[model samples]
Target: MRQDTLWVHREFRQLWAGQTVSQFGTYVGQTVLPLLAATSLGPRPSRWGS
Candidate 1:
């Protein structure tokens, strides 16, 4: 294979790895933040304007 082709492949692999990790972190944060908010804030009264 040509050197240029090899470089392209390496760059693609790096990009794929980065995107995968970023997506995983996003999913973890999405899952964790709501749980944290619920635990910390507990229930609140309705705000339907008195």
Candidate 2:
């Protein structure tokens, strides 16, 4: 397999920046999703003793 050396090239900075922004948005979504799931679970769903 060939490794993409785009990381060493200055021209790829825009691509990297866009990827970084997208990844950060995904990270925020993942953090909030667990809380959303907890809220939607039914009355006796205290599995972790919360």
Candidate 3:
């Protein structure tokens, strides 16, 4: 019987790495975009509840 593991596959490794980078970029954008927008727009007391 021959056993094969995904860790031994080059294509799988590349795919996994690309997915990881994409996820990290998405996470960074999600976290940073809001902060960037808030900083650029400044604070308005009237919009606090709405």
Candidate 4:
């Protein structure tokens, strides 16, 4: 029982690590693209839709 639980725990940790990395990359892209758009075009007020 303990070994099975440990295996599941390890699997969750691996999934969490991969998700964290991907989320971080996505956030970086989210920020950079807006900056690039404004810089090339002009300083424009921004609004985010929910």
Residue 11 lDDT in candidate 4: 75
Model 4 per-residue lDDT tens digits across residues 1-50: 47666446877889889999999999879998888887999965668734
lDDT of 1 by residue, 1-50 (tens): 57666446977889889999999999879998899989999988978957
The 0-to-1 C-alpha lDDT of every candidate, in the order given, reads 0.86, 0.79, 0.87, 0.82
Better of 3 and 4 by lDDT: 3
User: Which candidate model has the greater TM-score, 1 or 4?
Assistant: 1
* Model with the higher TM-score, candidate 2 or 4: 4
Among these predicted structures, which one has the highest lDDT? 3
Alpha-carbon TM-score of each model against the true structure: 0.51, 0.43, 0.61, 0.48
lDDT of 3 by residue, 1-50 (tens): 23477888789889999999999999889998888999999987885576
TM-score ranking, best first: 3, 1, 4, 2
Counting clashing residue pairs in each candidate, in order, gives: 0, 0, 0, 0
Candidate 2 — worst ten consecutive residues by lDDT sum? 1-10
How far off is residue 26 in model 4, in Å?
Answer: 0.3
lDDT of 2 at 39: 87
lDDT of 3 at 24: 94
Candidate 3 lDDT at 29 equals 94
